[model samples]
Target: MLAATKRVAFGAAVMALAVGLAGCSGSGGSEADEGGTKGAPGAKKAPGPENAVRLIGDGSTAFTGAQPNITPPQRLKPGEKPPQFVVFSWDGAGEDSQKLFSHFRQVAKKYDAKMTYFLSAVYLLPEEKARLYDPPKHDIGTSDIGFGDTQGIKDTLRELRAAWHEGSEIGTHFNGHFCGKEGGVGTWSVEEWKSEINQAKSFVENWKTNADLPDEAPLPFDYAKEVVGGRTPCLEGQKNMMAAARTMGFRYDSSGIGNQIWPKKTDGLWDLPLQLVPVPGREFETLSMDYNFMYNQSGTTSGDPDEHEYWGNQMRDGLLQAFDRAYEGNRAPLIIGNHFESWNGGTYMRAVEDTIKTVCVQRDVQCVTFRQLADWLDAQDPATLEKLRGLKVGEAPRAGWPAFTATDTAPADRTEKH
Candidate 1:
């Protein structure tokens, strides 16, 4: 989800004048809080206990696509049930896809969690395959970025089949994101949407070429014959996404949310909408201020992870609140879609895990993955899908938005991690 460029400018001013990214201590799953405010240099403070306890209800994760992108008769698509699952997808970031894929598998085991993971063809490298447990224990989903000039679509997913099985499921992450621009944002003609959609479909359906990655520093591989049956990137609205999904032959899409374009007239696409990911108070300014701050502060990005500590903590706290709201309210369960690169095997992922642990154990909360949710939904009658939260105005929250005391002071710029 992209913010307006105009709002970005205002945020830049706040960062430069009010919060010049004063360095704060950084932690990777470690419990530590550094001093944040009160007119002094970055200092250390308490972050409280590891109170990662029950805080919400049913959870699910969706990757761009998973467990064999478009499997052949993989037990007819499950019937519909209550859509309550968690989804986590990622573009193949840099060259650490395997590291990330392996790391999360361990995390999942520890929590007794099952999740669907979307993988770009690039991630199915020899290095990545080597890390996999025999028989492919993890759920592998496919996300193709055809917008990139290099890797071909069929060649991308074919690479996955050659690398691993059982865990592989082909699905589309749409054509943007890993390719840049659009970042999955929309406003394109439906035809343009079809062109990209069809390209992914064609690749997934016909990827039997059995090609190999190019011999280069960043390995680029050819995909085998495979077809993707799902997609979830930048499908912000119902009509656009519905038209696209129907045209593209997608069975489901892990896009949309209660907060995004909602209360739509159509239910053509199955939505695995993400929840309100917490952004930092200062992040709004980071994007707007990156350029100016580089010149102002020793040629560097203005809001490094160290400088944005409080926002991080606050976001972790807020996610718990969000989980609480969704569970306690009449709304359906919260499904999450997070980018692996966003966490990149670091403190951020741990923070999210902390929140997840807190929520999964909650009295009402029952954690699940997109596959799990879809299986549950598939088993139910289609009518149940109509009764979901993202389809209409979700049940109002049990608690009102926290009433912040607004003096004459301006609202502090805010952002949360997705």
Candidate 2:
């Protein structure tokens, strides 16, 4: 039954087309980072420090008490079937004219979901400060995705502040959105990747100094400690990127490809890659992302207006089918990726919003961020995770869960100190 669904979800032709499109461009970040910064500049003072806030780095970010709206993971009881975990993560997150970042924040709140937002550092760095960003293998101030205007930066800051306070995780999508053979991230050396990562962090840590937005409230969490993982632009450079991430104390990487099954560690970090999910009315799987569906369906970002509704339904149904397979069969965590763009006449955005509303409220469903997922994965017994890893895609244990985990017992919760 699961195999049949998989076949119907993705067609061979569709998969081939998506693969080709992926190589050409990706949905995470735009391919236009090659322009100078152009915007008026004036820094606003960061919000006055409160009792809970400890100002850090030119008052751009602060260390507050434990993040609100976050709960420690509880170990699974013996012989218990795992609850379905669904992670809705966005790459290159920023609030632009479309206001998708803020829009989704409200949507997540309505659905009782917590998400990960992979913030591109360039979004916070104003256009005037573009030269401050030294992207590896790219000219200074040269960004394939361009720099943010002052108003855009301010809007992004507001959302980032609110989102973190509301329990969302803020991860980095690195600096530039460079792809392809000519100075693409894939060609960057380990040292170059490290430089990019540092610059990304530096921009977040010193936004006040660079943007001169002193009056705005400092970002609520210590970005240095709060950021635990991120997805790479275009999902490239995982090999060296993972090496850099581990050394830099990152806990996970969500930039690879995988089937709808249990995740495991790679290069000392949780390898929570984007999954292959069903695409309704198709016979081959595509990555669980809005852009992949858009590419496969329209063959362009903006296709025929009349087909938008059908395309949206196809994506929604595909994700739902993928969720059911895990919920009923293997119970692997579902990781879905999206961007802030409104591709295919905003149909993909609508599809994603619909998917979140439908799945997040289901019984035994926990909508969490990658950081939360990693913490939960870490808290589990290694033996139990190993057993879970043994289950193939959509393959449940021959014995029922109770018998399958008969010897297992819930371990004491190991809560981390804030």
Candidate 3:
């Protein structure tokens, strides 16, 4: 999926119209407050000052209270079975005529799931303000995907505000959708990538100033703090991009390919690569992304309408098979990537929606954003994680978790025995 030639093209008019628009702490409690049904002894009260909202930079973003609907991550107890994690993420997420972004938000809510929307910065910059973006290696104001119009920006903002309030994460897909060798992201240097990252941040932080929509309510969360990770454009330039991301305090990078195994750190950051999954009715597997599936199934974004339903079922079944492999075996996190476009008569959308409804409601299954997944990973004990990493793709611990982790208590003895 990281191949430069895998880039998808969008209509210029569609691109021009989509410019888009578009934390907490605790403290000690008093004795009376403790007994007054407020909270347990020494437990922090809910809805306290930690939820207070503080406006930031041109009022484009704010430090709203703790994100709603996100459960705090707890360290996994020794020998405990891990939850089956499934992450459904979208690239270049925005609102347009198709309404795919908003539709997916509703789908997530219905299934008790949260998603990561990797927004393209240009979607917020109105077509009139195109010159504000100086894309790396591209001509001034030149974006392969054009800027959004006023109405498009307004709709995107509405959806973004609502999505965050519902506990969904907002990430970046960088600026331009540049891929391949000619000035594409694959050829970018660390410095060029840094410039692009900064520009992406700047566009989000100054949307109000640049677009002149002063009266609009500020975004609910601070972009700088909210955006801790992102998938690079077309999944290219990942090596240099990771270098830039580490310097920018990013916690994870999801722009590579890997098998269904536990994630590990790269350059001190989580390398949460997309995994290969079964392709229904086929002997081979493919990247767990809608685009990859579409490419393999139809060889183009828009395929035969007569086979749309079949394609949808194929994707849905493939993802489920992949989910079960990890769920019943190694228990590795399943990462699924998608886009907002209605490829193959919107069959992929339907497939994803059905997948969410089916998988998220199952026992011990958590459909979460990359941010939440990263938090859970960070909260676990290193030894347990190391044990998890030892499991090969789809390979469960034959001795079960109890015996598998029993060596933690006698590391030195285990070493000597080995």
Best by lDDT: 2
RMSD of 1: 18.5
Cα lDDT of candidate 1 equals 0.35
lDDT of 2 at 318: 90
Candidate 2 lDDT over 1-418, as tens digits, reads 0000000112213345244223211111111111222445764434543334588979998887677789999787787888899999998888777778888999998999999999988777777888998888878988777777667777888888888878889998887788766788889999998999989999999888887888877887888888889888777788999888899879999989889878999868999998888777777788988878877787777699999999999999999988888887778999999987777889988999999999999999999999999999888878888878777677666656776655643322211111
Model 3 has an lDDT value of 0.78
Model 1 lowest lDDT segment of ten: 22-31
User: How does candidate 1 fare on TM-score?
Assistant: 0.50
Task: List ranges where model 1 is wrong by over 4 Å.
Answer: 1-84, 91-98, 121-170, 176-187, 201-210, 213-241, 260-265, 277-302, 342-345, 361-364, 381-418
Q: Write the per-residue lDDT of candidate 3 for residues 1-418, one digit (tens) a residue.
A: 0101123633111112111000000000011111222567897656555646688989888887677778999888876889999999998777777778878888888899999988888888877788988888898887766677667677778778888877789998888777656897879999999999899988888888888999887777888878889887667789999999899978999988788989999998899988888887886787788877776777667789999999999999999999988887778999998888778898988899989999999999999999999999999989888878877777767656566666454332111110
lDDT of 1 by residue, 124-176 (tens): 22222222211111123222221211233223333333222333233545433
Report every candidate's CA lDDT: 0.35, 0.79, 0.78
Kindly report which residue stretches of model 2 are placed more than 4 angstroms away from their true locations once superposed. Answer: 1-51, 408-418
Window of ten residues with lowest summed lDDT in model 3: 20-29
Please list the residue runs of candidate 3 whose C-alpha ends up more than 4 Å from where it truly belongs after superposition. Answer: 1-48, 407-418
Query: TM-score: which is higher, 1 or 3?
Result: 3
- Residue pairs in clash, model 3: 19-123, 19-148, 20-123, 20-153, 21-153, 22-157
Q: What is the C-alpha RMSD of each candidate to the true structure, in Å?
A: 18.5, 10.4, 9.1
